[model samples]
Target: LIISSDSRIPSCGNSTLTGLDGDFVRRSKWTQLIPNTTEATAAAEAAGSSRAAGFMRLTSHRVTIQGANSATLQVNSGQMKMGMTYGFHLQVFNIYRGSNVGNSKETFLVSVKTEPVIAQIRGGDDRLLPIGSLTESKILIDASLSTDPANSTAKLNYNWLLSLSSGPTINTSSLQSLATEQMFFTTVPFLYLNKSSLISDSVYHLFLNVTSRRRGGKAVSSTSQVLRTTSTAVPVVSVLGGGIVNEAIPITLTLSTSSPSPTATYLWECTSQNLILTDPTTRSTSLDSQNLQILPSVLNGGATYTFQASVTIGGATGSASTTVIVNAGPVSGSCGGSPEVGEGLKTYFLLGCTGWSDQDTPMLFKFSTFSPTSTLELSSYSQLSSITTLLPARPSNTTIISSIQDSLGATSSFMFSLQVSQPDTFDVQDTRDLIKIRLTEGDSSLASVLISGTASYVFSNRSIQNTSQQASTVSGLVSLVDSLLNSSVSTTEAQVSTPLSLLQTVTSGPVSSLTTSTQGAVLSIVERTINSSLNSFSNAVASSTLGVLGNVL
Candidate 1:
């Protein structure tokens, strides 16, 4: 006997058998039992060939199972035998006649059941993503995905999202997607956000969704923990009231910023004429509470000072500076001479005195003289303040006074005295040489009587030669000689001979018998000698000579 069954039905179902007993008898079977040995042998051979082909098909193709959580299916390239002890009955048949009977016989018959093959899906493990600080408008989101060893053939797809607020809602308006090769399992996407579009002093959240999928398999998604974004603005610094300031005057300057960061810090600095101001409190150049006070001494008259302000916010810094100009006021100081000076000597009063503005101007001087009564005007065309002049020759002790005036109308006075002294001797030698006199007398013997003597004379008589108390009294002696000659010539001789002999000797004829010509000539000579002696005295004391000489005569 021979049995035949559908191979397709057994391949799609479970092929498990227990034993051949009453269970076999109760089970239904679709079989064609043949009585002819030749037909049975042919049917068994065909069934054996069909089963071989089905096994070959299972070995050549790969199988995939799709589900959220499913295991993988793999088939080996080899035949598997099915055995049963009681579930099915097998019949042996001889497909060939005579000698090849057992070689071509079909003997084995088995029932088996199988389930569908499944390909497992694995989503990578959950993780906390690392995020970098956002200093610019754009930032990079770099993340990686991994799977278990069982899902080695799975691929990962990443999607990055951002949310301004802490919630499930993500802003997709500016969402960006990244593409990579088929072998790549990591994504590095860039997220761009304008500073003007983001709220100030606010926190933001970032989410990373990773989906893993295999070929012909359903996708499984996994999300990362929230990541924070750090964004901050740079500080801007400005300086107020930075300009030109005068010396010794206090100037205030302020530094300000436009940053709202509580951690922001400010620094103020000042520089002038290549000098840096370090201590803002104790020094003339200093800063306090963002306010810089530049004292007058720091400005130093006419110098430029630079003020700088710097602000830092969240590790970002900015700075600004301004310049100040300082101007100075006018300043005032004097020049003079000693109390006594020599006559005919030059005296100088320093007009080059200080006490003027910083600007240059001319100086003027006025001089007054007591003796010879004169006034003089002197000027220094430039800033020089010294003046020089000659003290005039004065007959007596004289006083010279001068005053200096600046362009600013400031005045100062100076005075000095000039003294005149007489010579040691009242010498009339030069005056005597300047005068010549000739007397004419009768040719009898008066020529001998007309004695000629040198006009140069030293009147040693103390009575007429008093220099301290009075000048010489030679003029009064001349008048006395003339009076005596008119009244009594002999009496004139007696008074004249005493002082005259000390000056010059005059031998003449008898006074009563002397010719008119001889008398006139003698008298004229005597008068001229006295006049010349008195004129030799210093003019400083000469004015008192007439009175003294009158008392002596």
Candidate 2:
């Protein structure tokens, strides 16, 4: 009998084998008849052999398909490799081998070929590369064709094909691009040995093809998954950690985790065109000494600024970010100053006019502490008690007369000093009253002139000095000038007017701005009285300098 086999059945589908005996089988058998005992033994043997042959033919089919399809898969590894293979084998058993359509003694053939794998799956940006290998299965031929009889034609002539375990699996999406301050990593699963298989010694090589593309670009790297069978668990790494320390402001940062852990290192990277130092390791962060200091230039109008900081550990890196703000100092100028004693000490000296001017007199600067109480607290030295004008020595009140006669008569150019008895009365006076002086048109108290309190020192009776000789000379010059201007000389002028010898010139002549000059002379005399009695005044709770001013004025 001749028998043939078909290999069209799918590896995972139901397939059967049938046997056909021709007329040649009957003719050959008729001539080969033998004794009943021998024939019976041969029949039984043929029956057993036919059953075994049928069993082998029906069970020889093998099939294999990928766990994951041509779609992109994710795997974790360092490199890629190809030409490596891995597969899974499926064992089949004949369920209808005892059917009667054909004898059990049948021979069969089996084969397998690759099915066209569809296009690969689309991978997204930020996806990591996959690592591992591919697997292929093809039918194996007659074991019986071998030299060894132990494995006969009946044993190998079935539909059996060589089987392979599945290949390693990998990640096919969320690919990450390599950029400055960035890192990448991934996870992968590969084929594991099935200890339950009949052949325990079989090993499969895994191969893969890797193609990388930057965002919106074509593949830049393509390769196969390298063998990592001996390696321990591999983990995918990503370059995502960064940090910043803003010295201007307090340091603060936020950390993100790929997975939770008791402790994890975050990586951060920073780039500055100018570098103070470079650390070969931990490219995640580069800190310059300059960055540590908060520079005014980095700030806007001395306002706050911000940046980032990177963190790392033994080898792994993680990142956290924070912001910095800068602070500015105070502005400077000549604000003001403090006070001196009776003689006013020059206080705040404002330059450039400061939008104010000396009205008819020098600007009367007021002096006080941070706070002031009435005129007692604030005092002025250059008149201008109230008027806000910038004119100097403006007359507050003026008295005019066609003629005047008194015990001390007046002349065309009159110069005299009067002494007051109670000089101490000015002590404890308000700043407004400290330098007050009343100018009388003549020796009589009735006719008078009023000037700014600022220039009152010029007429202050307390400042008079008793030097009649100087007064006489001034009186002589005035009389001589009058005599030269007018030839008429009256003998009564001497008697009606005060004696020239009794008056005194308290101030030197030829002084600029008679108002200020006169005040200065008076102030000098008053300061002399205070200085002379400094010790005596300190000793006595109350002492009167009235005698000094009364005698001079």
Candidate 3:
């Protein structure tokens, strides 16, 4: 009897079990046989019961088939044994009893490794920071949350894999030859990313493979179905959660960014003196500071109030303004727009509560609460206002909970579903027009530039030894010249060359065409090319991709 999903072993399709009295049938004399659901439904129908019985079925029979075939069962980490390998070994064949193994075909035996431990990654929501020069550029990935069911104290090696495409699934077959020690992590790992480096608004990824040290360091379990990073450039902010608030209904306005910068302090301010501001003080540091509770006690009809949010991240400081209408009425909400978005694409959502009436929700309106883990890359946000969210890379049906309340503490929340469509195979293009190199407002001294971003390593002896230890004066001078020539690249630039080729090999067409590299390199080139005309950079930032690099030009 094959209970497909819970079946421990592969089915052999042996017909003898159905005809002869097997141990299972003989033990119970087939007396307590669990009825097949179809027969039970028929009996119920004949008995005049109206219930359809639905998809649930009750059966004692087991299913047996040749080799490992998963019809609907998705094997997760919890079900498998610790050390045993579990996967289809179709080539191996032998006689078996009731789907139980009888013998092994040594010649056909192939090694299969399942996840040794449950790998889980936790930090917080999709970050509000992209890679830049600062302590906030990296985030700590907590693999300690990962569990090794057999031995908790065992030493596990971590290999953090970085990618631009967010699969959150295991697909190393497409990536190149696994690289060297640079990526292997240990204990808590910190991953850094630069979204500005990409030609488009591509999200970065960081996931680790938890390997057992005692088990030859083979990757048994990997952190999958999760994309934890985001590409929210700092200094950009949007306001949300407020529409028309009456004295009874309070409109809570929140300022949010794509990537929230921990170091960046934000100041949220309102210009309207008519409305009473709750906690009138400015918000600068914490998430709570980004939220403002306003009592539209003064608004009789509708008053348009302007709010400003300013942030200083790294060496960049920017401020944005938005306006909300305050009136005495009920809050209206609509799952804003673009009910569908391709996974991993960054989308801007309109304010959840639009005007005084219904129908003002946005992409932010379509949210899904995926369980067990936030592995699907759903950006965490409330449905109140304009928001920048990185759409999940994995295709899934999302549930967006949208609601709004006015000053009277009246709350209105409705849940809707958003469909995240499977991503199309990307058409690679060079979008340098979207890229701009605004050097952080800091010292860009030559030495500081070379020494800070990365480290340079050289043997001390290699530099002076060749000259001073040389046999003759001529050789020493020659060695000194040779050493100077060898020192062409700064200390940190030494390790930079290898990853270029490695990265290019693993990336896609335009990326493989050196577009990503060119994009980064050309930023400097473009900066230098247009150094005199700072306005060109602004013009480029304003450019749209109509198949011409007009902005770049």
lDDT of 1 by residue, 322-418 (tens): 5665554335444344334442322322222333333212345544443332222222223334444433234466555555544434344566655
TM-score, cand. 1 vs. native: 0.21
lDDT per residue for candidate 3 within 307-343, as digits (tens), equals 6666677866545454455443344445443435433
Among all windows of 10 consecutive residues in model 3, the one with the lowest summed lDDT is 452-461
Clashes of each: 25, 68, 32
Candidate 1 regions with alpha-carbon error over 4 angstroms: 1-232, 260-262, 271-273, 280-288, 331-355, 359-553
> In model 2, which regions exceed 4 Å deviation?
1-263, 266-270, 274-306, 311-316, 320-553
Question: Candidate 2 at residue 49, lDDT?
Answer: 66
lDDT of each: 0.36, 0.23, 0.36
Question: Which ten residues in a row are the worst by lDDT in model 2?
Answer: 368-377
Top-down TM-score ranking: 1, 3, 2
- What TM-score do all the candidates reach, one by one? 0.21, 0.16, 0.21
